[model samples]
Target chain A: MTKTITLLLHRGPYESEYADLAVNFALKAREKGYNVNLWLYGDGVWTPHVKNEKDYPNVGEHLRKALKDGVNVKICSRCAEARDVVKDDIIEGIPMVGLFDFTDWLDNSDKVLTFMR
Target chain B: MKTLIEIFRNTPPGNACLILTKNVLSVVYGESFDDKIDEKMDITTKDFEVQLHPFPSKIAEENGIEGAPSIYINRKLKIYGVISPEEIKGLIEKAKPVKIGIIITKTPNANEDVENILAIGEEALKVGNQVELFLISDGVWVGKRGNTLTEKRLLNLINDGCKVKASRMHLKACGLNKEKLVDGVTISDEPYEDLVDLVMEQWGKVVIF
Candidate 1:
């Protein structure tokens, strides 16, 4: 069975180290042959709001690196709804899921890392 | 005993602070009954003692508060931001674990990440679990000896048998060495290996800050 790592992020881009570090960890875990699940909760749902950036760092773009490498990503629907985050507000192809979805990921994960404030 | 709930909010008041405060009150005590009276003064359940800790407050500073609307339950359990009533209930009812691995990745005093980390470690110890910590990035600064609040908490955790390891690379990057660190903080060369092993094999849960 392929080992899976669940990275639960609770912070958004430029807000703290979690967003940037979560992306970096996700990509590295993928490269190391681990299945990575990026679960965005709280302010983490806002990470996908930013697009391309020339001068500043856009974690979404860096997150794309992990996504392109088959890293699974999900955002909490409750958090999204509370923050008024619609499907269009986030990167395409990622699903907004319920908090219960995290329970399933937790059970399926070999390791769960919560990246919080 | 009234359940003491400490709510932390940093400099520059946040909407979440107010919202969380509102939600917590409403959760414990339903919305105001009197329609003519706008402000809800009714207390359905008066078991909770809520303390709002705005930034720069003496008690908050003494508590090593890291605000982003952080909440501490009875000065023990902590959760970031607001949570559902069900979730808060679950946190209170949570059980013990065999091992807990905590990673602190930020420099201390810049914020209260150290407080959160140390508190968790101490609680894990109190619960009779093996607690281990890895300090990476600028977080290695926490290993340095100091007379500050953060250091006191770290020392308490260490004295309580919580194992702490500092990243050698980060310690060097910050121009620090074994002599500069506190007595109990371990500065090992191959902590990444230990961290990986602990996260993958030993720890049932890993909380990174």
Candidate 2:
């Protein structure tokens, strides 16, 4: 049976290494042939709000790569609203979800990691 | 303080109804005034012509509100206080063999987070749920011998059969090692891998700080 790993990212991008690590971990886990999920909570909602610029080592780019590589990603809708990050401000295809949705991921995951401050 | 909302909601003559919140009443009628309302906010619906009247606090006292935050549906007291969020979540979740994973990444003594974690960890174990704690980053400081408040609480969980592990790499970075850790605290050679195994295979739920 294939194992699933869920990563909950609670920090914003650029300000710290936490978000980048989570994205990197997700990519690495995916490379290992595991099903991966990325749940962006709290300040983590700022992660996908970035439309990455060229030539910069942006965490958003890594997140987009992970998303393209079959990583299921979600952002907290309430957190996004608090930061004034609308649906159009975030990366395409990622969903703005609720707190309970993270629990749903937790309930289904075999293993989970929380990347935060 | 909490406020309870209730609608008298009679037969209504048919299908029309009106709703007024406390906030709206304060804005219109002013918080201090008590006036006999001869005119009503009238609206005609398919069924009934409804009259909406915002009642006063004095009338609420007449409705058997001996204490505040009490609701009166129709001359009868309903909710007296508030229902906690935990109670609601518990109602949604079933009792099962749940393995709880806790990851601590901050220094303790600055806050009672470790104490809270100890309480939760003990309760989980008491209820026959498996509990695991991973001490990483500055969390390695929690594994020290004399952790003040953190040590006593952490040792309690360790003695209670909770699996407590510290990140060896973080311990080294923080100038701490296995020898300086609590008696039963184990050091993970590869914290990330162990964390993955803990979350991915060993545990069903996780709480990270």
Candidate 3:
């Protein structure tokens, strides 16, 4: 049966390979015909704001790919605002959801994987 | 009897530090000393990993009780001072492994994260804690054909009821065939996303390395 998998990413982009692993897992889930959700919390709200320039592993690009695969990508508003990430600073199509959204997802999701650094 | 120094040096993380000051001091200096010492030292932080012991009188010799207000990290002397709660918190965090999901993405090499995970996971098991390890990305190599001590330990962990798994895609990515995998690994047919969810649903904490 198809499962609704929630990837709760708690690490920021570029600082480590966690964001990449999160996106990779989401993509792999999508490939297997599962519903995926990427909920960014803690330092992870910094993911969309990461600059995608040059040889650096593009966290934005991977997140964009996950979105393309129909994964619901969201960021914690409070966390983002704490890091000075205004709505305009985030990647297009990504929404700044509230902390309640994560709680709701946690209750509804069939599974949850947290990528904590 | 283990010295307070040894206890402090050997104290595991997430465990509380016990400081035994003389009861005589509590009588002479007034209970205010206990109150002051306890107030000044708060071990439990945002997460409840480490705790502060409010000077219990029992088990005095276990604490190497030589003097009043003797500070013990795992029952060892930590010298008298305004103990840095942050430092104690850090030590507690480092020494303890909570019931959690540990994902290994890096290939096993000399002194790699997998070895640490295995050691910590094994220790947790000894203490009757649960540790679920997922081998994804290059970490699938641990499940692939190999008879190294590390790989053998992976199998032993599985046989011992440890939840160890390898991603089929990752195994394939590493050019490993499923038939070649060491026994006792759950090769998920659901893909990486499901595996992530599976681990998370079961564990309150996740550590990726």
Candidate 4:
């Protein structure tokens, strides 16, 4: 049976390396056929901002790909408000929820992973 | 059944007892030791099914062991439990292994510090050791994506199968975005007290950075 893995992300883009790693892990896990859920909490919610940079790989793009591949990408509503992130400002396909939802996902999951910066 | 009876007689009815005597001094002795003495005492008194005995000084006593902060099972001291000389070895081997808890806090020197801690964790993993790593306080900053050495090292460690955790409350306090963190990191809703209890229960050794 496939295992459900929950990833609690707590970092932001251009601040440290966590965003990149989270994307990579999601991609790899999807490739391996595991059910992966990526939860954006705290500062990690800002990761989906569409970057205008020329050289860097887009975090939002990575998330979109994961979503296309069946990964559940979510952001914390409380975190977004605390960080001044508006609903419309979020990337496509990702929903803003609360800690309770994250907890529920975790309780129903087989494994939980954390990525912090 | 005979072996079980012998074990029951030698062991004090619970899990093996572990003594971590690390660099702690009795004041009167004017000396320091590097083991988990209090932890050992607690385990000895607890109502668990199996026992884990920790002997931190069997090395300095030169009984021919090489690591400090080491564990001695059945009078045999080893660095990472590598030596045994008798049939009792099998019994000692049957004892439950210790869990290790590692916490990395973000600081002004967050980048380099997380990298170093991850390197240490990788080494532990190489030895077939399992550990739980928690990122709390400013340490949550290490979870940020892009332009940091610590981030890269942390991702590598996660890929290599390290259990990574972070404090959810701390992240909110710092206004850090959970989406920006690396994949495979779990946010802990449990309080710091719970974290401490869990670590104490699982790990024989707890290292903080």
| Per-residue C-alpha lDDT of model 1 across residues B147-203, encoded as one tens digit per residue | 376677778788888888998977997899999888899986865555555677677
- What is every candidate's C-alpha DockQ against the true complex, given to 2 decimals? 0.24, 0.25, 0.24, 0.02
lDDT of 3 by residue, B1-209 (tens): 11112222112222232332222123223434454554323333223222333333344454545433334443322454324444444443444434567778776774467788788777766544567788887777777657475777887777666887777876786788767888777786655565656554557666667
Better of 1 and 2 by DockQ: 2
Ranked by DockQ, the better of candidates 2 and 3 is: 2
Candidate 3 per-residue lDDT over residues A28-101, each given as its tens digit = 77876778889999999888886456585687888877888899999898988888888888778888979888
Which stretches of candidate 4 lie above 4 Å from their native place? A51-53, B1-209
Error of 2 at A65 (Å): 5.2
DockQ of 4: 0.02
Model 1 lDDT at residue B16: 74
lDDT score for residue A19 of model 4: 77
Q: Which one wins by lDDT: 1 or 4?
A: 1
TM-score-best of 1 and 2: 1
Fnat per model, in the order shown: 0.43, 0.43, 0.48, 0.00
What's each prediction's clash count? 0, 4, 5, 62
Give the poorly placed runs of model 1, Cα more than 4 Å off. Answer: A55-58, A81-89, B1-97, B106-116, B119-129, B150-162, B167-179, B183-197
Note the Cα lDDT for every prediction shown.
Answer: 0.75, 0.69, 0.65, 0.60
Query: Per-prediction TM-score, please?
Result: 0.57, 0.55, 0.49, 0.45
Candidate structures ordered by lDDT, highest first: 1, 2, 3, 4
How do the candidates score on chain B by TM-score?
A: 0.53, 0.53, 0.51, 0.53
What docking class should model 1 receive? acceptable
